[model samples]
Target: MTDHTPSSRSAARATRPVRTKALSALVHGICLSLLVGTVAPAWAQFKASPAVSPRIPGNRSLSTELKIEGMQATTDYILAVVNQEPITHTDVDKRVARITDTAPAGSRLPPPEELRQQVLDALIDEKVQISHAKTIGMDISDQELDASIENIAAQNQMTLEDLRNRMQSDGLDFQRYRNSLREQMLLQRLRDREVNSRIQITEDELTTFMKEDPAAQAEVALNVAHILIAVPEKATQVQVAALLSKAQAIQERAAQGANFAQLAKDNSADTKTKDQGGALGLRPASRLPELFVATTTKLKVGQVAPVVRSNAGFHIIKLIERENSAQATYTQQRARHILLRTSPQQPAREQIDRMNDIRKQIVGGQTSFAQMARQYSEDGSGARGGDLGWAAPGQFVPEFEKALTALQPGQISEPVVSRYGVHLIQLIERREVQLTEQQQREAARSVLRERRFEPTYEEWARELRAAAWIEMRDAP
Candidate 1:
């Protein structure tokens, strides 16, 4: 059923109140999970690492009586459980409050009871995953939790303090917010460990996969660099003209053998790439900004273009290299493990020591990587023996990719650290995949795996929600 339009509520509120409600609800409606573009103030003040969960001071009630005085209990008192965990009606109500106006301005909000049920269901699903995380012993460290919260705040374009104040003004409790954030972090970690880690494409597989992907097949990676003279956002036509002229002179210097990197560092207005000699990296030609593609595609590697104009400013582009994509396929080992985050208080040394010991035990035949993962690894992969099935070259963090690349079949990598945390990786098995075959068997496998992943992930979520204990009472 279509959701309800919240205009009635807006109409009932005074103008200023409506504006505040709209602003808060509108922004929250668009609030993305942990990863997203731009920073918000919420990220700054609410940063909590995985290790930062100080257990609730003590078990407490999970419901609050609304003080509406004359209003009756218009909504049903729903109590549900995911596996052994209970989800109170209040939990559902809170989520509904955040999402009531989320549908486009005109849609009707679902009935309060119905919305509560949905929220309850979702919370249950989340709990299942959390439970699975525990079974596999996945953990979020203090540092990672803090960084994720900070990142969310930044994405929302709010400083940490500002986000906290905004939440307070909106009647949202800080700890509740932290709990919500932690759950999301856990879900993401679980997905990575369960599904994403297992997905992989070999060089040949990637080659074939690329050939089949209309988007990739239609495009090629172009290595390019540029020198730009920019007009300030508020610059006048005259000022713009002067900047363009300056660009022309700089281009001349570049053409006359001045080092492009040095010149870019000194003169380019494209700050993102200026220090790297205006290098835009190996980006798909089709996706390059129109002006960039138009100018650079026409020039051979090492050739500099005449002045080009784009939204940012005027630019001179140079093509460095181009890679034509071909058929893709992969055959590789898949393994999983949990992660343990490192922090100043629980430094890398501590995590390293712990993981190293696990590695030693596993190596000495005292324990399996899977057992060690479940017992100790901090990554969500711990649920499944640190199995990241078959991955393509660039799928993992560079450090992880490097370590994985160095392992032989059945070989377990020494404890390796990535931005996420320390990991104990094991090599399952490696297989050769030929995309040239008619069935493109391996490619077909990859496609099937991709298709199955979503539902499997949903099931995994269901599993986590089935196993967690959550309460929704407001803080005292």
Candidate 2:
């Protein structure tokens, strides 16, 4: 993670900003989504059926059920061993079950034998990586582990106690669950350190990437105001024609110098932005819906586009502003957040409830946001009225970023759960800025790193597995 230095006004809370990191992609890939499946205990039921082949010692068929010591009676056997660490038949079954359960609807799976071999290979690779992580003295602290568990609980909308009780109800040992989480964290840390260190992006590569990347080339920011004449679902053709006529008339009025804002305020059906003069605010072309971007692409400022029909209805759009510069620019946001750190002492649900009340008070004008933040926020930013200064995309974690993007200026978001803690975020404002030369290079570097992360990780894992002593025991 890279630390962000706050502006002079908020310098006292310089360290309070949630640092940005290139590992956000990896976090989502290896930590958040994977942990949900990897840590959850799966109980596989192996029904008694006729065996296709005779069961040999140390070579049990899939249908064979054998009682194992210190565990429930189930069909289990040693499948492989990596550095003396055994992978069991039960482990494979559980993994297979998870894959099957989580597979997208209508997706096809490989043949059973092929799938089993693939799962076994993946298990061996995991064992090798875990062994290497431990060998390198990489470790996850108890505090970090606790935070990760809390994050998982928050993501599931459960309190810490609720998570514990849910796990117990599912017949999973709490300590075992914690161990699984720790392992995942260790794996994430290991990959971030090792894989990132291997990637190198040169100035030439950066320049080429900037030129060749389609998104980078078309770096345009747009501010558009729209008036929607909504067409109700299953409406008659006459009703549709009437709505279309209304939209065309509004577009004509807007083009003929009628007050667009007033027209939107009075006639626009989009409740969220209608009162804001139908302004969608400044956003990059990538952030705006494709329909809006397409309609406004060739429009000059103050020009009104012809009425366009969509699934929702007809839209009369005005191009408020367009920034299509030679230099890449993006919409940056200045947001402030009141963070409440969650722990066993103050569970997530309690903190969430508290944040809700605080939001209500601030919204109702009973208390100022800054005052409440100063009184209740746990982070150093509290001293600076919880200001997180100007930030570009990818500066915050994905969960935080998603919530921040959804809020308008001065709008406080509902309690947002991130790995760090729960936060009540208020977007201060947004601005469009051209990236400096150095900033552009840095942005290119980030993109290059993301592109390299996956392949580098795979190569690193393969190397670890090849160096380890892997023995395949039973072939099933």
Candidate 3:
């Protein structure tokens, strides 16, 4: 994690963009796919280790093992400390360089020393979060971490050897990058448990906000999906020409109403997202990359955009759903489902067969869904007859959402496989509501959630740091 900058990269090879996952961190690991939110391309699940181990899941315990192994009394400078953990000048310098390297070109950046302080603050916050997550016994297994790396490689259209060689050539220590990755996943897991789980919005608050807030009521949301035809760096003229042709073909197929998700799964370079058909989740335009925002401006729901090129490569985009708050209205589905979880004992096929029979029982009027769900559903909703309640778009994951969209009221769907398990879905009824009470609450709940997330998390960070024994060492 020394002051290694991609701008000064030594690698002659360019990494391809994998538009797999989205977050506000360094993503893509390439020049082409850079966007406002860092494009995350890996997911590792590993057991937590020492303070240093949480940074990266690799076996190299550099923080503890290498700190003094080859040290000199005068060369290594102390920068800061949190508890007994030390931060070296090298740490500060690396972060400063990373920030500088990743900043948008032509944007005015602060002095390196000033950026050092900000980076230091961020590191301290990260250290506190990692410490907390470790204390709580959250760990990602090495196998899981390897899977993340594999996905990263796969998404970039490279093998693990290729990725390692690229990193080495770029003057980045591969082991150090893994450590950075580990810290990232650890922090994300902590937030999911501590911060994300606690925030809640009340029904009363939603009703009040909907009635009173005019401007807030008019915000728009777009549900977009994309396919990346990634072009590797330093591609030959012929290579670029072929990629353009491929992108054009994909775009043409999309416009002619080919199954976009299937196309994405079959052809998308970003494997992390191919399974979900490149679903980016539901988000506002403000949260999206400007390129996407502009591309979708004239597009309609269920419509496809022309092949759009960026630094990364060409994109075949689809506008899955969109909403205008000013004229906000949605058809809410009152639905319930019975889940037959795929376990070692039952397996996926058995679960599917069982679910089919359950659907038949309900459809054939042998028994009510609620009774069946109450008797057999493995999830909490079983007690309520699998009543998931009313949901607008984005309430459920994409697989479930897509299924729900297809069902007419009182019609049952074939067993659908989601991450949760196999489900037999029945849409009880559907109604179009204009700022309905339930709609307002759900929206306000989400709005309030977004409002509380950042500041609350910051406050939480400060609290953790406060509780730690941190000391600032004079920079030499």
Candidate 4:
């Protein structure tokens, strides 16, 4: 097996989260501090340290941790050597065990080796993202990471201390749990940076696509607001009534012209978007609780509605924005770009120079933008000469689409930085986007891309594994 360990790989894998099922089990939602001093005595199970920890300068704990990890018995092989890393049978066994624990009691589980291989593949892909993140110098602060961890733990119905103790009882180490949280957080950051930040879903595209599927088009947008009081899933009748009354009072205040958004900010317990002034932006009406949609359509913009109760919490909703079922206006835009990729490992300047060089070439007419995009655009659409086919407003990354929409046909944009990379774009054509055959094809493609993220991410993991260095040893 080929070995590609960074000169630094000898330090043992402790500081890096194990990226296995055990780590996922302990701190699935909560943050790292939940694991403090919670490691149980080594059991028969294979143990890998969770990698989420505050980075100490030259810390050697991870190496020591893994030396101990190897002491456990290996039950099965997880994956074949990729590059050189042997994802062991024991690793697979742990992942399957963890999955069984999380699954409903009677669920069928994957065979030992099959589950192991899948988990190992995912782990390798995660490593690619982590490695990429490091290249771009993207690091999560321990404070924010910890806060995220705490939120996750609370959701799992456990206190930080209790969660740690449970992990110990399961023969898992708390540090490994923290490391997993850190890694997942890091992956989220990278995904946002790599994909979401750069993706543009245009209003025209949404309209055209939905038009092809009457069901999708039939969906109406709901402008919703709520005053939430969080109660346990099994709250008493008196407690539930008290919470509902509190919601009613908040609604009364809202009807009296108290700042509805500010009221939500102050009183809403739906922390997800409460701080956004209780804005659940333009959701499909069907997805709203039946009572909410029924009342929402009856109110005009800025009108407060009656209180609505749902399993999530109690709420008094107000209508802030609404879209009638009328079809949206769309404008087709053709654009071209030259792109340069940046990662945490590379200095920003390295790619900046490359983008600038590409920009200079276009300006100097050394090569057309389309030719350059075919050669260098890192995006999937690069194959189409960076033609984002047709976009209406809101279709491209806001920054990119904004630049494109501002240009007349044949106008070229200056280099713009988006999460994906730096891009130089041009507008080639402009036309109103209404439902058309061309639009339907693109719409179907868009639907597929959204559906494909998880599988795509998994496949990407496999590809990374195929190219990475991994080491495996026989069960000791």
Number of the top-ranking candidate, with lDDT as the measure = 2
Cα deviation of 55, candidate 2, in Å? 37
Worst 10 residues of 3 by lDDT: 59-68
Q: How do these models rank on TM-score, best leading?
A: 2, 3, 1, 4
Off by over 4 Å in 4: 1-217, 286-298, 324-326, 330-336, 341-349, 352-390, 393-421, 424-476
Which digits, one per residue and each the tens of the lDDT, describe model 4 over residues 401-457? 556767888877766644344667878888864545444444343443343443444
Tens digits of per-residue lDDT, candidate 2, 1-476, equal 32233333322122211111212211111111242211111211111221111011110001111111122346778999989999888777666665555443223456577666666666676678779999989898898778767766776677678867766665556786577657656665666578767988887877888888855533567899998888775679999888888889888989999999999999988776789999987665654667999998778899999999876688899999886534646678998888887777877778888999999999999998889888988767888789888887756655677788999999999998766568899999999887776665564455455556556766777777779998888555
Model 1, TM vs. native: 0.41
Q: After best superposition, candidate 2 residue 72: deviation in angstroms?
A: 11
Winner by TM-score between candidate 3 and candidate 1 = 3
Model 1, span 38-127: residue lDDT tens: 111111111112111111100010111111111113354437655567665555554455454323222233456555555555555556
Candidate 4 to native Cα RMSD, angstroms: 16.9
Per-residue lDDT, model 4, residue 446, is 43
Q: Write the per-residue lDDT of candidate 3 for residues 1-476, one digit (tens) a residue.
A: 12123233211111211111122332212111212122321111111211211122111111111110111123568878776777777666554544555443223344456556655666676777777888889986665455555534433445567777776665556676676666665666676567656676676776676678642344467788989888775678899899999989999998999999999998887655678998787765545667987899898899999999876677899999887744666667788887776544554556777887888888899999999989988766777887877765545544466687899988888876543456778789988767654444455455555556656655666677778888888977
Error of 4 at 344 (Å): 12
State the local distance difference test value for candidate 1. 0.52
Prediction 2 global C-alpha lDDT = 0.66
Better of 2 and 4 by TM-score: 2
